[model samples]
Target: MKSLILYDSMGGNTALVAETIEKALGARAMATDLVKVDKDLDIDVFDYDLVFIGSPVIDWLPTKPLMDFVKRKMKAYARQGVVKPSSPLLPGKFGVSFGTFAGPHIGEKEALPMTMWLNSFLEHLGYAALDQWLVVGRHHHNKEINLSGRLGNIEDRPNAADLAVVEHKVGGLVDSLSAWCA
Candidate 1:
């Protein structure tokens, strides 16, 4: 099995989550790689059996770059495959999405309103989202310390305790993904 993790982070929270998932999967014969989302990303997604994407929630939705990456990548996947009569966008692979919010105030309320939109877009592009998750931590927005609905007063970046929760969540996601691939 092979897996890839693509992410865009402002405070490295999302990157840490991706790493946790990769470690938890522990694929013996898997080739796993992580990359920061680039403007001119030229990755080949067909080679991987599983993919994980992490993005910082902006304006209660995924950042524009993340959304654009999803759209472009999915479209590229579709373009490389045989086009069906009705459906045009479809990938030959599967993937998942994750977001990291501040503290513990992550609800569908405002942290990630674009979650569904991105998921639907993935499906439209032919990629199957294996699972989705959200993590809580400290994030700065608009140059101010803004908690995306999470609790606790974070004076600085997430400490070991905060990272542990993210690790646990990602570990679970990895377990479920491994079982799914099995």
Candidate 2:
């Protein structure tokens, strides 16, 4: 099945996560496409069987560019009647939302709001929202700033530990998809 990993990263944390996912899926022989979200990128969300949308949380929400792309795609889906409640959801279509945050908050309190919003948007567009991932990233610009959370002082976040979890999640997702298809 074909997959897509689309992301926006300012400090490169989210990009690393996106690329890691792409690599993991490719290692399993799955065809995957990676795109860095930008004005020049012309993405058709319906072209893929599985999609991973990721971004670094900015001000507790997706970056403006990411939100703009999502809004635009959602509009197109709605125009095509792909987002209507009556349209049957595609059983094989799935989406995962991921985010990196430097906020000191723990657990769901940190990134659930943004990630869940993303998941809901994907579901609205007719894809089953499979899962969400939240990884702690370092505050690259300045850890001294009060806004930087728990691991803010540390550089290289979404670090080794965070990446291991991402890798494991990808493996599990791939295995589950294989089983479902089989």
Candidate 3:
């Protein structure tokens, strides 16, 4: 199956997760495209069977570039009249939303809104929601917050162990899909 790892990362946390996902997909022998969300990005999400969208949480929301990409796709889908009421699922198409957050106030709770928002958009476009992954990230800009956050001392997070978990999740997802197809 074809897959796309589309993400936007600030300070490299989310980027590391995205890369791990890409490698896992590769191991599964899926044809996957790894793309970083940018102002000039013009990708067709429908071209892939599975799409993984990720971002780094900024103030409890995804980065503006990734949000903008979603909005642009929504508009384009609307123009084509493909966005229907009740958003029926599109068979064989799936989406996974992932993100990195340094939840200073509420721990991982800070990443929920961002993940749900992205998943809702994918569902609105008829892709079945497969999963949501949230990883702890260090708040690099603020030394105090990084040390004092609810998730304390995450300076080395999204580390090898964290990425191993992500890789395992990806393998399980691919195996599930393979079995479903079989």
Candidate 4:
């Protein structure tokens, strides 16, 4: 099955995770498309069987650009009459929402809202929300937060160990999807 890894990163942490996910999908012999969310990004999410959407959690929400992208897509879907009141499931379509958060205040709690928001959008579009991943990332601009945050010393986060976990999860997801499809 084809997959899409779409993400937005401000300090490269989220981008790294997105790349790891793309590599893992390739290792599983899946055709995958990696797209960085940008001002000119234009693509149909329905073209892919599985979509992985990610962003860095900023102020307990996804980065503004990513939110804008989702809004644009929602409007387009509405105009096309593709949005259903009940959001009936579209067979063979699935989505995974992921995010990188420093969580200076409340640990993983800071990232949950962002993940849920993205998943809600996917569900509203009729794609089954398959999973959510929250990866700890460094608050590069704020040394105090990076050193004393709830996660503690996350400056080197989304590091190799974190990426390995992401890869392992991708493999599991692929296996699960295979079984589910069969």
Residues 38-154, candidate 3: write the lDDT tens digits: 998999999999999999987778899999999999999999998989999999999999999887789778889999889998999899998899998788788787888878888
State the weakest 10-residue window (summed lDDT) of model 4: 149-158
- Give a tens-digit lDDT track for model 2, residues 53-89: 9888876788889998988888887897778885457
Distance from true location, Cα of 152 in model 2, Å: 7.2
| CA lDDT, candidate 2, residue 54 | 86
What does the lDDT come to for candidate 2?
0.83
Per-residue lDDT of candidate 1, residues 46-159 (tens digit): 567677777777777777777788778776756876324454444346667777766334443555555555556545545677666676646655224442234545544456
Superposed by TM-score, candidate 3 places the C-alpha of residue 139 at a distance from the truth, in angstroms, of 1.1
Error of 3 at 118 (Å): 0.4
Clashes of each: 7, 2, 0, 0
* Residue 37, model 1, lDDT: 84
When 2 and 4 are scored with lDDT, the better candidate is 4
Q: Score residue 58 of candidate 2 by CA lDDT.
A: 75
lDDT tens per residue, model 4, 31-135? 999999998889999999999999998887898989999999999999999999999999999999999988888988889999999999999999999989999
What TM-score goes with each of the models? 0.73, 0.91, 0.97, 0.98
Clashing pairs in 1: 90-126, 91-126, 103-137, 104-150, 104-151, 105-149, 105-150
lDDT of 4 at 54: 93
Show pairs that collide, candidate 3.
Answer: none
Estimate the overall C-alpha local distance difference test score of candidate 3. Answer: 0.92
